[model samples]
Target: MVTVPTRVRLGYAVGSFCTANFTTIPGLLLLIYMTNVLAVDPLLAGVVVFLPKAWDLVANTLVGQWSDRTVSRWGPRRPWLLGGAAILPIAFVVMFIGPPLTGVPAALFVGAAFLVAASGYALYEVPYKAMPAEMTHDYHERTSLLQWRMIFIAIGIGMSGILAPILAGDTVEGYRLMGLVFGVILLLAMLASFFGTANAPYTGQAEPEASLKAQLRAARTSKPFMWLLGLSSAQTLGAYVMLAGAPYFAAYTVGSTGATTTLFAALVGPMLVTMPLWVWLAKKLDKRGAMILSGVLFMTGAVAAVATPLFGPLYAHLVIVVVGVGYAGLQLLQFSMLADVIAYDGMVSGKRRGGVFTGLWTAVESAVAAFGATIYGATLAIGGFRESDPANPVTQPQSAEFAVLIGITVVPAAIILLGVLMTFKYDLTSAKMSQVSHDVT
Candidate 1:
């Protein structure tokens, strides 16, 4: 087994801090920013949230292909990491610094900014996700490395998820301040990853595939990867749907905006403390078994949360802690599984196509994350949610409050439950992976 340095593990994991902040804050706040602050209709706000990420379906793939063929002093991925560090923060700040406009015009402005931000994020994320497979060849080591990432993910999500809402509050100026503060944090995290991974190993040194089509064809033909993608994408969609609904659930069902912080703390706190436990679970059950257990845990929590109206906010918070336990497992295992697939591909095909695979993974993930917000927005619109500005604060109807409850609970639970079928279909095991590695060596 090849061992990775603590610095390399840390450098790579820190990049997740950037990813978690960008992904969580937007899914958490952007839709409400539109519906509440900009006075945009719920459905329109959902569209605005969803549309830009749709561009990522194409852009992330192209960036992945580009990074695969890139030759740089900084290496294939770091150059793009630097590019993202420079551009994404600017676009992110622009996304939330809601201009002096309302309705469709405001939606249009955010969408445009978000489009650019999505592109910038692709520049970083696709290549960043590809690195683990290249950094080390050991299957279990991939899990160990990603364990650090989950820790950072927890911290990053915890900090951003809890604080961003407080910083933004319910006004235009509040959002701008939130944007600037997080934007700086984003820049620093990205740069830290780029500089930190300066001396990491890169063992997957095969020549790049001739074209994106060829690389994607390779990924499509990999059964483990395809199954993993389907289930993982479903898991992402469910998690983000709940994330998008958190603020609404807190404000309407719990009757306290401050509950957002408490809820996030509940969700992320387990992730910090239980990552080692998840790593151990993966070892005992293998990645697929551990993932299935985690999904069940997540689904159970979501279902139990539906009773929050009966039990109150404390009940909702406690159930989410259960969800958080499952979330920690899902987050760690999915990427570790992906790393296994990528490494298998490198050994079997002898091509440097990790970027392409990761590109596809990140693209589907980003789009699904956005769609989670869109789905929640559509749910609110269906419940006849009223949009209003701070100047005219609107109290949501009973139906709207119910919509918040269901969106945060039932919708995600159902989505995650559906993903279990795909998880069952995934067949990669440690023995099989070990054979593949032995064959290659």
Candidate 2:
């Protein structure tokens, strides 16, 4: 087995940190900022956030394909990494500064800036994701490497969420301060990864020249990959739906704005703390088994969340913690499984096409997530929610309970169930992954 250096692993972790900061900020707070601070209609604010992410569907794949073909002295991935690192902060700052003018100008500014940020994210993220398959050919080592990266990702996400509120001081300041702080953090992490991993050898094997269409066609034909894509996209949509509605749930359902922090913490904190345990479970059960187990846990917790009116917030939080544990497993295993699929594709096609696979994976994921957010935002509007009134009671129009229940439970449960059903199509196992690694090496 080829061994990689500690710095290479560290660089990988830090690189993910930079890219994830953008996701964490908007993921946790953008909705609140739009509705409460900028005073965009809540449903409209949701659309503002939702529209930009849709760009990722096209942009991420194109970026990945372009990176795969490009040759650079720094290698295929690092140049884009450096460029993205430099520009991401500026895009981030623009995204959260809110529109300078009201009406169309404001909406246009938010949408345009968000699209720019998503592009920057694609540049950095697709290359960064493609790195692991090239970095090590060892099956177990890849798992270990991904575990460390996920840990850093969890930390970056947690820190972004925890600190954004503190720095914001209020909704207006929160968006501005979060933009600045996370922007700086992203810059630093990007630089660290770029410089630190610069000398790390490009261990990736070469592929026969193929058109982008051929590469995409090859990816489409991979059954295991398609299964993973379906499962992860569905599961991710559920998670984003729940996350997108969380702030509203805390404020309205629970009758406390402060509950937003508590709810965020409750959801994210356990996953961070239990990451190691999940890693152990993955090792013991294998990625597919772990993922299946995660689906079961999440489904149970989601059902319990729907029962929150009967059980109260305390019980709901406890059940959600159980769900968080499952989420942690899913997060770690899903990417590791993706890596396995990349290796599988290489072994079958006699090509190193990690960039194409990762790019497509990311693109599909972005599209599904964007669609999920759109549905969520539209649902809130249908439920008769008005962003204008912060003090509106949960029982208003007596329809909000249904909205909260659907957002927190029914939607996610259906998505998770679909993901579980799709898993039967995944033929790749740990043994298969091991064979692919052996053949590649």
Candidate 3:
């Protein structure tokens, strides 16, 4: 058994704090910012949200391929990691500054900022995801490693998920403060990983396939990769949609905007605390099977959460605990399973293009999440959510409340079901993983 040093694992997991912060801001808060601060139409805001991830899709693949072929002393992935870390915070602050301009001019600034921020994160995240396959061959070890990684991911989600809104308050000034403080947090986390993981052994590409076309071809031919690509993207889309619904659910359904952070704490805190239990479940059931079980659990929880309003005023938070448990399972297992698929690719293809695979994985994930914003914003627009004014607060209508409920409940439940079905095609059981790892080593 190859043991990954505890520091290396800790370093790698800390990087996820930055990734989670980047993901949380846009997923949870960005579109709302468009409606409230910029006075952009909800439909237009959705369009703005979806369009920039197009750039993110392109960047993930290009950078993934770039990392695979490059030869450097600092290592192909590390140099880009450090470079991206420095540039990302600048764009992070820009997204929240919500320039003094209004109408189309304001919309354009936020859109442009998202493009830059998403692009910067691609450089860091694709390489970061790729590193795990190279780090170890043990199947359960990958799960354990990723379990810690997901714990930090939850920590990021918890801190930023709840804190960003509190810090930003319901004002433009609060958001500006949020941008500066959280931007620093993001910069520090990424840099910590870059320096802290200095002792990690770098895996060089052994095969000669270097072109982007070649890399894409490699990913396309791998059946397991294709299966995981769809499954992971679907579940992530569901997760983001559910998160986007939280503020609305709090505002319209639960009747308190201040309940937003409490809802987030309910979701993330329980998920974080229960991660070790999910890890144990994955060890018992194997990653793919564990993910299937998590999907079912999440689907049921999401559906059940919809009815929490009938129970009482504050009952929604308690209902969210169920969703959080299932979410915890999915978060912990899916990434470990991806690591398995990457290992399988290295073995069957006789090449270790972990960077390209992870890149494409994240790229498609960005593209799918684009639709999550589209779904959230377009649905709210359909429900007649009045965009907030700079001078006055906004009240949501029945249409808005209805849209949020479905997005949180029915939509996520369905998306997760598809992800569970895709798992039937994901064939890496524990016994098989042993063979896959041996083939690579």
TM-score of each: 0.99, 0.92, 0.96
Locate the minimum summed-lDDT window of 10 residues in model 2.
387-396
Ranking by lDDT: 1, 3, 2
For lDDT, the strongest prediction is: 1
In model 3, which regions exceed 4 Å deviation?
203-205, 438-441
Best by TM-score: 1
Off by over 4 Å in 2: 100-105, 389-396, 437-441
Q: Write the per-residue lDDT of candidate 3 for residues 338-440, one digit (tens) a residue.
A: 8888877777777767778888888888867776888888888888888875697766677778887877788888888888898888877888878766765
From the highest TM-score down, the ranking of the candidates is: 1, 3, 2
lDDT of 1 by residue, 237-315 (tens): 9999999999998989888989999999999999999999999999999888899999999999999999998999889
What are the per-model numbers of colliding residue pairs?
0, 1, 2
Residue-by-residue lDDT tens digits, candidate 2, 133-181: 7777666677777887888877776676566666764455566777887
Error of 1 at 341 (Å): 0.8
CA lDDT scores, all candidates in order: 0.92, 0.74, 0.82
Model 1 accuracy (lDDT, Cα): 0.92
